[model samples]
Target: QVSSGDSSVVIDKKKDRRIRPSVVVAALRAAQQREPKFKHEAFIESLALAYDFVIASKSMRPGAAVKLLDVYNVLTIMPGSAREYTRPEFARDIYLLDQSGHVTTKKGRKMSLPASALTRSGGVLRTVTRNGQAKDYAGISFEEPGA
Candidate 1:
């Protein structure tokens, strides 16, 4: 707001909190940090496919699970993208998948990934949980959704 006092013009900004939407958007964009684009369903589905491939070749049963390393190998073997799929990313995805409950009957359909699925069989895929707890999962098993 502007006011004419004597021979001088005074401007007051204390009450002017309004800003143009475009300007605000520009400011926000400039200050925004890049976030990871983790596609939950796609990534998880890829993981499940890789696991299936590994499990089938190994002739794994419901009580048995393919090694984490084996699954990772299957996923990275063909190099689907230019950016390499790192072990850390694989680990994080697994953790996120578990937390999502998408593979269990509790949430996603036609799958039951019990705690036994993540039991450490041999070598481990160490991951940090959503709550920041360090976890190690050696293998993964998939069962009937209602199981």
Candidate 2:
């Protein structure tokens, strides 16, 4: 059993090179049962790690903002590797992170994405706004979270 705080992954055999999908699903289900509110906790943690990487490199400053697209890139695309965490999926996670972040779908977390001024060519996220345009939450703000 490999345990990290409340999350635990128990495999019967440690030497097995190829694990079964059912085992993974079972572990995940157990974790969810343990804590249902933090549904998107992995997404939030990954985003925070990526954001910290960008900040540490001085691509952005302390108490400053980083582009959401950039964070997605750093998280998904490594120097010599690639991943399939698509932008639309990232956008959805971001939307949920804002809506039900702090509590079990009740409060929000410390992270925030303030509005960004976009030009005609500025990046746009499909966060599903009622209006034609969504004021573009193009960047993420760590300042508000007291970075």
Candidate 3:
């Protein structure tokens, strides 16, 4: 298992090999199970590993745009587990990360932003209109729990 602080290794490994689909799914499931004790950090670490695995693996079906739902489906299929492992919030997190260009597929395609960047920058900004007035709206602020 990869340590939380060693995400760089995971990212680097993704660039070199084709990870197995089952390994990716297992990493995600492990992250979900460990979330309660380790909090979001566990999720982040697990996410990095899983993302790397998915991108490096060709078993995800060729030409199919990898989506968070696709990852979630794998999480939902774990055996002997009754807990809800998949959540829209988690999927959104993955989507935002992908949008940031930090993660990438095996084909050298970028995915999204790094979690650290999102936490430090207060997230992506957007334009919002209310009462015919347009204003800049800062995206959601993501902080690790208890931090």
Using TM-score as the measure, the top candidate is: 1
Q: List pairs with backbone clashes in candidate 3.
A: 97-112, 97-113, 98-111, 98-112, 99-112, 100-112, 100-113, 101-112, 101-113, 102-112
Q: Write the per-residue lDDT of candidate 3 for residues 28-122, one digit (tens) a residue.
A: 45544442322433444555445444545646432233443334444455774314442434544444343344443333433333233333444
Error of 2 at 138 (Å): 0.7
Candidate 3, run of 10 with poorest lDDT: 136-145
> 1-147 in candidate 2: lDDT tens per residue?
445554544442223222456877665455434422435667676777787788887766665667777777788775543334456556756776776654221123356675546323466666543232443457775543323
Models 1 onward score TM values of 0.57, 0.55, 0.29
Q: What is the alpha-carbon lDDT of model 2 when measured against the actual structure? A: 0.58
What is the Å distance of residue 7 in model 2 from its true position?
41
TM-score of 3: 0.29
Q: Candidate 2, after superposition: displacement of residue 22 in Å? A: 34
133 Cα displacement, candidate 2 (Å) = 9.3
Q: How many residue pairs clash in each candidate?
A: 1, 2, 10
Q: Of the candidates numbered 1 and 2, which has the greater lDDT value?
A: 1
**Once all C-alphas are superposed, what RMSD does model 2 give against the true structure?**
11.2
Tell me which of candidates 1 and 3 scores higher on TM-score.
1
Candidate 2 ranges beyond 4 A from true positions:
1-38, 79-83, 103-109, 118-121, 129-136, 144-147
